[model samples]
Each structure stands twice: as C-alpha cells, then as structure tokens.
Target chain A: MSPPAALRAAGLVKSYRRGRAVDGVDLTVALGERVALLGPNGAGKTTTLLMCLGAVTPDAGTVEILGHRLPRERSHALARVGFTAGYLPLPERMRVVEYLRLYARLAGLRRPDVAARAALDRFGVSHLARAMGTELSSGQKTLVGIAKAVLHRPALLVLDEPTASLDPDVALRVRTGLREISAELGTALLVTSHNMVEVERLCERVVFLSAGQVVANGTPAQIIDRYGHDDLEGVFLHLS
Target chain B: MPTIEVYHGAAASFWRVMAIARRHAYVLQRSPHRLFDIIVWPVVDVILFGTIGVFAAGRLGGAGQVALYLLVGVVLWHVVYQAQISLATGFLEETWSRTVLSLLVTPMREWEYVAGVALFGLVKLLGGVGAVALIAWAAYAFKITTLGWGLIPVAALLLAVGWAIALFVIGLVLRFGSGAEALAWGILFVVMPLSGTFYPVSALPAVLRPIGTLLPTTHAFAAGRAFAQGAATPWHELGLAAAGTAVMLALGFGYVVWMLRVFRARGFVTRYS
Candidate 1:
C-alpha cells in the first residue's frame, strides 16, 4: 500500500575481537524524513551507518534499503542511496568535477556531467569543480563532498559529520540545500553530526546511540521534554 | 537540467562500470607517475633489455634466433608484470587517496569495480607492452610474430596468471590493510622465477623445479620456446598451462571476495585513512 521506509535496519549487530561494535541496534527512517544518528566517539555511529549502506555487513541484522535487502540486493538498494563522510577524503589525484562525475555516474545518472555541475552550483561551489583534491581547504573539501553526495538525488542520503568543517554561514547554506532536496525530491536524510543546534535545525528526529545501542530516539522536542533538558545539547550531554 | 532517470538493469550497470574506467582514465591522463608507470618505464625497460638481448645473441655466434628468444621472453614478462600491477595499483590508489569507502557506497558492485579496473588494466598496459614489442623488433630485429599460432596461448596464459596475481595481491590488501601493501608490488617477483619467463623449469633448482612446473606461465613459456625452435605445438604443456590458469583464476577471485567480506565484517570498509 504505502511506500516502504527509505531505510529499515533491525537488530543490527556487529562484533570484532574488541567486542561488539554494534549491539542489536534497530532504526527506521520514513521517506523524505530527516533523522540524525548522534553518538560520542567509539559509540558505533559510523559502523551503524556503514551497515545501513551495506558497506559493513552486520553479524546479525536485516537492512532493507528502499525495500531491497542489503548485501543480497545491494546494487539495487545502494543505487538509490548516497553516502558521504568528512573522514572519508576525496581522491587526491582527481579534480572535483571528475570526482563528482564519477559518483554521479556510479549513482546511475545519465547526464552525470550536467548533474555534477548542477550539484556544485546548488551548494554555491561551482568554482571549486576544477580544484584538485589536495588544493581544497578542509571546509571546502567537506562542501564538495556534500555536493557529490547529493548529485544523484538519492532516495536516502547519509551524511557523517558532513558539515563539521564548514563556516556557520556555509553550513547554513548546505543545510538549506539538504532540506530542499528532501522536500522537493523526497530524499530522506539520515545524518550524524556533533553540532546539536544544527541537528535541531535540520533533522526532524534524533537518535542517540550510546555503547552501540539506541539510548534515545524521538522528535527533538519530544526527546528534550522527556529528558527534561534545555536543548538537544543538554540531552546529548546527559547521555554522554 | 534534463530529467535524469534513475537507471536499472544491465545497461545502467555497464555505464556505472564505465564510470569507474573513466575515473581511472582521467587519473592516468593527469598523473605523471601513472603515465610513467604505464608508458615511459616500459619503454626504458624495453631499451635496456633489448640491448642485452642483442648482445647475448651476438655472443652466441650471431645466432639471431637466440636474440628472438630472449627478446620475446623479455617482452612477455613485461606485459604480464604490467598487467598484474595495473589491477593491484589501481586498487591501492583508492586506499592511498582514502576514497575506498566513498566508492563502496555507490550502486556499483564490488565485482563491477574490479571488472572496470581490470578492463582498464588491459588498456593501461597495451601501449607499454606494444611499445616494448616494437622496441624488441626495431632494436633486436626479433619479431614476436615469429612464434606463429603459439603466441596466442602464451599471451593468454601469461595474462591469466597476471590477473591471478592481482587478485591475490588485492586479497592481501583487503585482509591486512596498508601493512600488506608491499605484496601488491612485490608478489609477482616471488612468482617470477617459478614462472620461468626466460629459462626452462628444468633449469631451476630441484626444490623450485617442482614449484615452477606447477605454474601455468611456466608451461606457457616452455610451449613458446618450442614454437621458437620450430618444434610442433607442445600440446601437453599447453594443456597443463590452460588447466593451471583455470584453477588459479577460481582461487584468486574466490579469495578476494572472501577477504572483502572479512573487511566489511571488521568494519574496515569506511575506516579509510
């Protein structure tokens, strides 16, 4: 009847010799809904994100992306999912345009060059397209990474500390673009960031992961009220 | 902007693989080191080795057949080396650039990435191998065409083993990260003597002869020598070479795929640095 959620990850678990990295974590994001996965360092936020994207296969769990089972139908699922992280750097040898075009084509865009340029323009960084990967400032690199992530208009867009390096104004601009994509293209946004205020501004829901488990999940207002916190930052501090 | 349709089926996958190739093509075009690795270095190798081959032939009472044998062997070895290095280095480039996670996130399958780069590997070495072949002829007057129909199997067997080495190196990288990076560049040298590129398996030490004979490239080279000597096609050796290639290929592809699973399970896929 209704379209399946953009992402549905249930009882996702992954372990290493160091012990369990993700412990039976479950998450769901509706189509076009904006959600944030927030956690402290070593809290397994990135691991959960990777599992959702099929980059990391969980030892125990089922991840259905855009209604397609992960690893089995990864090609079908990931075709509609785009992911980016500031920690995952761009190729040093590639120009920004070429880098964006590569991801665009990989996402199945027929006119990848046009889409790449448009994405850059959307983020007001069209001039950086010719810049070599090493030449970009940290903030500029993150901006280009976001541009690359959104170029394909993926059904579910995942970002990891995406705007960590951007100036406030640039961050606001990028956030606005993200909102526009979700509204116009129904591109569900699943993001992880430390900027609590920006998270409040951008995401409709917040998921707090602590020690590889969901400690809290609800709307920002609901979570704040339930935790009796002044803001999302207070709740995050309490969780930590 | 034109409406960009979300693609499906084989056609979309084909283009996605091409995008992988296109990215590599751009890197090759822009990076001086890559261009040198694929082109200039091979030319220099050809010149240096071709000269030695010519001197050796001269030393053998002006017997040009010896020159042809040495020259052909040199050319084939370089071709296989270039072929093997292309795939391994193409993969290592992603790790070096810290972009493996970004790559894995897309719709492109792992096999597609390997296939695209492997195909590019062919393109990358063609110019270099061709250049060496030409130099072997121009400097030594020894044409590879002299090997006749036998050349096809020799080249195919060598390339198969080359691809096998690449898969093995890639598996090592996926399993051990950059710590095993040396394997990507150096594994083939370990396989070189066992392959008998310039010498017969019988010439190896007894301990190595057994290992040498186990290699497809060894048999391939032995068959090539028979052709050079105007002997009939060495069907027995040729058969052994083809069968060995089949087994190595299966093991290679299987091992890499397994290593990828291990990598993903360890959550190292996106931990790229």
Candidate 2:
C-alpha cells in the first residue's frame, strides 16, 4: 500500500452566521511537494487553513496530517506539524533564540537549543539570534518565525503569506530558505499567498479559490496557459 | 526532514508546561512593568490596607481585633487576587503578543497550557504573598503563620477560589473575545465585595449573608477570623470551604473546556487575522 499523503483535507465545509464560508473544499499536499492556496478576500482561505490545522472544527469532512486525523487525533497530528503566519507574530518580549528554543521543546526535541540554533543557521539568520522580537524588523521577524516553526523538522510546514510584507530583497531570502527547506528536508509545503510571482517561483502547483470554492487547480504555467494569460497574476486578475 | 519525533505522555506534558512558564519567566525578567506588578503594587496594597485595618481597630472598639479582622482579610485577599490575576494576565499575555494561535498549533494541549500558566502564577504569587505577609507581621503584628498548620488549608482554599474564578473569566474571553476581557480585572470588583473579603460574613446584611456564605473564600476567612479572636482551629468552617472549593474547581475547569470547544466550533479562534 502507498504511504498516505502528507496532508489530505476532503469535503471540508464551514459557515458563519452570514453564510457558508467554505464549501466542499478538497486539498492534498504530497510529501515534499510544494503547493499554494491562492484567493482574494472573503474567499475562505483562512477558514480552510484553520480547519486543516484543527484550530477550527469542520462542519463536515475529514483532515488528516501525515495519516493522523484532525479534531480527533489533533494532539498527535499537531505534534508532527509546524505552522507559521504573519498574523501570529513572535512574542515581543522574548529574544529570537528564546522563542525558537521554547517551541523546540514544545515539539519534544531532546536538544532544543541545538535544534533552535541549527534552524536559525538553516534560515541564514544566526545574527538575529539574540535580538528581542521587538527589535527585529518585519523581514527578520518572519525569518525567525520560520526558524521556530521548522526547528523540530516536521513532515509538513504550513505558511500563510510568508513573504507578504517583505521588501523584494528580503523576500528573495525567504524564498531561497523555503526552497532549501522543501528540497533538503523534504518538508511538504502548504502555503497561502497572493504573491503570484513568489507562488510561481516557490510552489510547483496552485489551488485557486473564489467565493469559498476551488475554481482552478493546476501548475502555474498550465493555469496561465488555460486562461490564455501572460502570467499567473494575469490569470488571477482574470479570475478576480 | 521527516525527523519529527513527537514527545508523548506525562513527561512530555511536564516539559511543555515548563516551556510555557519559562517563556513567561523570560518576559518577567525583562519587563520592568511586570516586575513592578509582582512587587510594587502588592506591597503598596499591604501597607495601605494594613493601615486601614489598624485604624479600624480604634473605631470598631475591639482594640486589635478589628485590625486583625481586616488585615488578615487583606493578606488573604492578595493571595486569591494574585492567583487570579497571575493566571488571567499570563493567558492575556499570549493574546497581546498574538501568539495564542501559534501556541495552539503546537503539540501542547489546552490543559497543559492552563496548568503551565497556573504553575507560573503559583511561583509568582509566592513572592507577592510572602512580601505582603511579612509586612502584615512587621507593621501590624499579624503573622499569618500564627494560623500554624491551619495556614495550609486556609491558603489552599483561597487559592482554589482564585483559580476557579480566573478559569471562568478565561472561558468568557475565549468565547466572546475582548468584549469580555474587562472581567479579567473587573470581575474582581464584584467578587471582592460579594465574597466579603474585607469583613465577616456575619457583618453583612441578611440579604447578602447567604451570598457571602456561598463563597469558599468566605468560609476560609471565617476560620481565619475566628482564630484571630482566640478560637482554636475552626475545622468546621475550613471543612465547609474545602468542600465548596472542590465544587468550584469542577465547575470552573469544565466551563472553560466547554467554552474552548465552542470557540473551535464557532471558529472564533480564526480571528487571528
């Protein structure tokens, strides 16, 4: 029998009082495969991510992370999963090393400090180790956050708009680090971003959502070709 | 790297809990305001209130009895308040830093987080409560240790009451978000007056007596007060408070867990955006 996918979220549904936010969304990310979920505002992207992370219970459907089901086996699933997002910033009072070390321990690493240092080195941000969260610039914070997330080297790493706020140069650094993580660690990447250029550069495939449902799912080049657009952004503009 | 080796069971839970406490400790070590909170204001409270208790002795015609009554109440009040504030604010710290969702995604369970914050609170209030106790002794000739071995149960019941109240407030915050955040401090306004922390339950009016009696802290205070007035061990009252405290913990912990589920179901936790 084949190994289960790194992540399989099937037939997911969610609703708020206003209306259904996510409707019958199915998403899967294979081991070491890089995929992005792209959508505009109110497209239910965050809701879907939260459900898959087991932070929000689904109205209907099942989500499995590395073959461990969510909302039921949430603890076991979370133990092997690492997540980072721009919205969830690092703790302002904690130094970068302190934050990473704590998460490493939380992930049950035997040598959290060593693992944290290796993660910092992997992201090429070892100089920011002693800086407090309040001291780091936005780009630096994102790097530290990624290091913290990957410290335990989980099978899957979920990132939300990981480079959304950075300057082009810093964004390049982030993209390079993420690509290395995907290639060297074989960490399955499930990303959400509006940066179509970065999506094309970093992710092998794209899943586009509009009004709470998947409207397009293919390789960036294929999606662009299918829509007769010059690039992924043009395709996005076409969909929007 | 597929190097994920997730820790499991009780031992892992211990380290996870300590990780949370250590995170707070780092904040505590660096933030001046946090240090002020642990030391300055609580010490000021002891001096300010202990003076009142001493003045009330003259006004109430009991020499030192009224002093002990109010002073003992104030000291224990700090004990309970410290437990509640420490836990509530520790949890609040996560929200302010926007790390609550991050912590949730980790292998750490909800109970472990709660216990960790409560554990930190326990470590913290010891210094705060001890400082207050020392001042109460030096300034007002009121040594809490005079309660002797009885001090254990008195402080235990009071701490239980504090934790119960804080847990419920946390549940409110989880379900309602910051709309209920004020209760983290404001609820104490109602709790302090209703629990009769400053006076004897018998001193309260008939309409309010039953309400005061219902609080485990009230029963615990009654024992402390009886001892101050030269009665030996007030086991009957202590016994009652202990039983009441057990009920309170069950209700408080259960309420928080249910609210957490509701937070998940209603997807309020997605507000991290």
Candidate 3:
C-alpha cells in the first residue's frame, strides 16, 4: 500500500483584485518524500505554501495536512508540521536557547530544554545556544531557525529558502540535516529554493511553478529529461 | 474525545503564548535602562511642567491647581501614548527581525497574536502608570482617593483605544513596510496637541475643538480627568467613549484582516525577488 499523503491541496485558487496569484493549483506529497517547489520570484510558490500552512486562506480550494483541513482544524494540522522561511526571522531580543525552548514547548515537547539542545546539536550550533538571536551571523541564525521548527520532530517539514543566506559549507550541512531528518523520522519535506543544484541534489521530486500554475511535476531526472535540459537549473530557467 | 483534544490543544497554546510573554518580560527585566526610561521620562516632564506653572502662577491658573491638573493629564496621557507606541514598536521589532511571519505560520491564529501584543502593551502601560502615580504621591501627596476605582474603567477604555490605534498602524506597516513607523510618529505628533493632554479641550481654538472631539484620546482624557477630580462622570459620555473605542477596534481589526488578504493575494510572501 502507498504511504498516506502528508499534505494535499486540490484546486487551490488564490487571487488578488488585480490578478490571480495561485490559479487552481493541486499538489500532494507522501510520507518521507522530498519535494522541491521551484518557481521564479512571482510564481505563487510561497502563496501555495502559506495556504497549505494555513497562514493565508485560499479563495477556493481545500488543503489537508495529515488529513486535517486548515484554519478550522489548524491546531491539529500545525502540531504535526514544521516550517521555516527566509523572510521570517526569530525575535532578535530572544536568546537562541530561549527561542528554541519556547517553540519546542509550542510544538508540544514535554521537556523543551532537551529537545532544544538536541536540535541545536543536530545543526552543529550548540555553542551559540545562549547567544542572542540578533548577534548570530546569517548562517547561524538559519540553523537556529530550522532547529526551532523541527524541535518536536514534526512529520511534515516545509522550508522556504532555508539556505538562502548561508555559506556553501553551512548550506551543505543544512541539506544533510534535511535528508537525515526525512530518513530518520519518515517526514515528508516540501521546500522552495532558488538554488536549483541544491534541489537537484537533495530532492527526490521537483514541482515547477510558473505564473501561478504548476507547469511541471516529476522526478528530478524525469523533469530534466522531459524539459530537454542538462540539469534542474536549466529546466528551471527555461520554465521561469 | 474531540472536546478533550481541543481542550488540551487550547491549554497548550495558552501556555505557549504565556511562555513567550514571560521570555519577553525577562528580557525587559534584564534591560533595566529601558524600564528606567519609561519611569524617568514622566517624572522629568512632571518636574518641568510643575516648575513652569509655579513660576507663572499669576499668568496661569493657581500654581497648586494647575500643577495637580497637569499631573493627571500627563500621567494619563503617558499611559495612552505608551500603550499605543510600545505595541506598534514591538510589532515593528518583530517585523524587522522577520518574526511576525514566523509566528503566523505556527498554530497561532491572528487573534491570539494580537492578544499577545495587547497583553504586552498593557503590562508596559500599567508599569508606567504605577511608577508615575507612585512618584506623584511621594512628591506632592497627590491622591485621587474618591476616584480610585474609576481608574480601572479608564485604563480599560484607554487600552482598547490604544490597541485599536496600534492595529490600524500595523496594517500600514504590513502594507507599506517600515516606512509606516514615520507615519505613526507623525500621526501621534499631530494628535497629541489636540488631545487635551496639557489643557482642557475648551482652551483649544474654536476650529480645533471639533478636531479634538474626533479623537478617542479626547474622550479618554475626559474620562481620566473626571476620575482624577472625583467628578460624577456622565454615563452617557462614558458610554459614548466606550462605543467610539469599540468602533475603532472593530475597524482596525477588520482593516488588518483585509490587509493580510491583500498581502497574500499580491504574493508579498514570495516577492523577495
């Protein structure tokens, strides 16, 4: 039997008065599958992710996370999902450990200290645990943000531009961490990034979005083959 | 079973919010200079105003009477101003640090987030009020003994008004970006002189009185002054104030909801490119 889909959105329609941002988009991700959402700047990839996370409501469509609808049943859905975004940083006044502990508790961890420490260690930033969030470098902040999201070991992880500002070495560490988390916890991963090579290296499948629509969806190699491109970057540039 | 699950989840969310509040409070505690600034600014203003009144007693009202009046106005005005500005600045800090979007994606609803910010604002306002009241009592034996209980209702009204103003400003912040801070400051400066903070609304120029009446701060100041003087508050006027505050809050919240919709629709979430 196929594993249950960790997240599913059907006929998702989100529009502004001026134009549609996401036009009748449909997407699904099974447990433990790593899917990369690839799109240009205004392709509505983040809108789709925000809708799935229940941060933004779709004008028309249904979204289910772990088989639970959003906004109405969001508490149940969000409890099982973890998310990170380049646009959303942690509170600057908060210490790394304090912020992690707070989110860990929110994510339903009983002993938040242990969970926070473990997450920090996993990302190899335990030394910076007591530092203020504002004091950290961009790469260090990204690691802590990711640690905060995954402290409860969520079954579904949604990350947006997770490695956008990181050094290549730190980005590789994060990539390794994402793969390890998916493997160990059987967590489905849906991530959006500008780094096509990172997506090619880390994701099992890729979904290409253009002008608020999913223009292509398939395995990385299959998408490359279908688009007649040398690699994921070539395909992304062609579609974008 | 579903009910029990919801209960557990709500309890958990409440604890999480409380935890964030506690962390924030801890940070405030560590930064004693910030706390000192809140308290010290009011004291310095009181002294400066009191001195001016004393020196110009013949030109102004009786020195003692004018000092007492200004004390009430300054203390109450400070609370309203502090509450509004602090809440906006707090949210601005979150936006600057990119944490508002982070919290939005959590299980927390928009209402809960607003509640948390309002709660923090309330704490800050109360602290400032308490410090000012204490200093006034110590220095001048100032007492609003008969009107003490009225402070509660006045504070509640002012808090609602402040939160409403903050919400409207937050919508602008989310839409126009950090430039909203300058707008907020400008609005506050324009509103303060007309708010009857230093004098009665009757003292304003005939044309300005109508403008003053349009502000919630005018009603808040009237309510607070009545409470300070132990005057019988006109319930009709109090009701009108409350109603006006409620309308502002409702409109502010509605505006925020609409702005969020617009932000989503416009793809602001992914417009970094």
The TM-scores of all predictions, comma-separated, are 0.96, 0.96, 0.85
Docking category of candidate 2: medium
Model 2 chain B is weakest, by summed lDDT over 10 consecutive residues, at B1-10
Off by over 4 Å in 1: A1-3, B60-65
Determine which window of 10 residues in candidate 2 chain A has minimal summed lDDT.
A108-117
- Evaluated at residue A97, the lDDT of candidate 3 is 90
Please compute DockQ, using alpha carbons, for every candidate against the native two-chain complex: 0.75, 0.65, 0.36
User: Which ten-residue region of model 1 chain A has the weakest summed lDDT?
Assistant: A84-93
Flag clash pairs in model 2.
none
Give a tens-digit lDDT track for model 3, residues A26-81. 99998888999999998999889988988777999999898888767887789889
lDDT of every predicted structure (CA atoms) = 0.86, 0.86, 0.78
Which wins on DockQ, candidate 1 or candidate 3?
Answer: 1
Kindly report, for each predicted structure in the order presented, the TM-score of its chain A compared with the true chain A. Answer: 0.97, 0.97, 0.97
lDDT of 2 by residue, A39-127 (tens): 99889888899999998898999999989888778888887788999767788898998999899888877678788888989878999
Lowest summed lDDT over 10 consecutive residues: which window, candidate 3 chain B?
Answer: B1-10
